[model samples]
Target: AKLRGENGCPWDRKQTAQTLVKYIRNETEELIAAIENKDKENICEELGDVLYLICMITAINEEQGNFTFPQVVQGINEKLIRRHPHVFAGTRYKDEEELARQWEAIKAEEKREHRQAAEKREP
Candidate 1:
């Protein structure tokens, strides 16, 4: 973020979420292409680019008081644990189809919870 401060690069300081999102999309495509081509070096480079954009976006949101980086990490960690009952809870799945069903159910539950929270915050 220092590179986006007062004495930072003029271009970097001028970037917004909208602009950074374009870079994120492009980097994602490059990563996908690298995977398709089985290019390990390009895959690593693209992944780094994607991570940089994500971090930059998080920093911008942090500046706006929207959320902290730790909140983002915590949310993903909790979501993973909540979704993977087979791995974390010793629950057995009969097959891939059953595992997928369980995953979708967990996702739907998460969506419902998010909607309820949003409704609670609405006037």
Candidate 2:
């Protein structure tokens, strides 16, 4: 983002999240195509592009004082650990279907918690 600072790249400096959304969406589509084509090299490149966009968005959010990158990382890490009790807490599922159902349930619970947190944060 230094490239988008006071004396940074004008192109990047002028870009907002709305402008970058298209690029991120395009990169996602390219990544999906690469996976469908089974091209390892293209997949790796596309994945890198997607990661770059994610970081860019995070930086933009941080600059706006909305949230930090660490918060993003922590949220995902916590969600993964919470969702996968089988892996993290030694809880077992009898089958793939059962595991999927449990995963969805956990996700719904997390969504509810997030909604409540947002409500609490609102003025």
Candidate 3:
């Protein structure tokens, strides 16, 4: 609340979800540069910067009462569990080829479900 309050930094308060694109792109480039340099230290530092931007953006959404960080994390964690059949769903895999097949199958199912849900929406 304080961060988004009037007393907060004007730059931060004025930021919208759409405005973060350049920031995300810049952080992504920085991370890529660190990786290309083969500098483990810079890689770690730049990764933190990228993650910080993500968190900040999440906070922006939360201030608007759109979604919270825990909700986003939970959704992704559940999706990971849903997607990895061989790891958690007691599905058998023979090799990397079979693993890839399972992953794609799970992904396609998720996509179909999402599409169906979207189709049902008014918008």
* Candidates ranked by TM-score: 1, 2, 3
Pairs in clash, predicted candidate 2: none
RMSD of 2: 1.4
lDDT of 3: 0.87
Error of 3 at 11 (Å): 0.7
Q: Clash pairs of candidate 3? A: none
**Per-residue lDDT of candidate 3, residues 60-121 (tens digit):** 88988989999999999999998886778788888999888878988998899999999999
Name model 3 segments beyond 4 Å from true: none
Worst 10 residues of 2 by lDDT: 3-12
lDDT of 2 at 35: 100
Residue 113 in model 3: lDDT = 91
Model 1 TM-score relative to the real fold: 0.94
Each candidate's lDDT (Cα)? 0.92, 0.91, 0.87
- Total clashes, candidate 1? 0
User: In each prediction, how many residue pairs overlap at the backbone (N, C-alpha, C within less than 3 A)?
Assistant: 0, 0, 0
> Of models 1 and 2, which has the larger TM-score?
1
Measured against the true structure, the TM-scores of the candidates, in listed sequence, are: 0.94, 0.90, 0.89
Q: Where does candidate 1 clash, by residue pair?
A: none
Report the C-alpha lDDT of model 2 over 37-58, residue by residue, as the tens digit.
9999999999999998888888
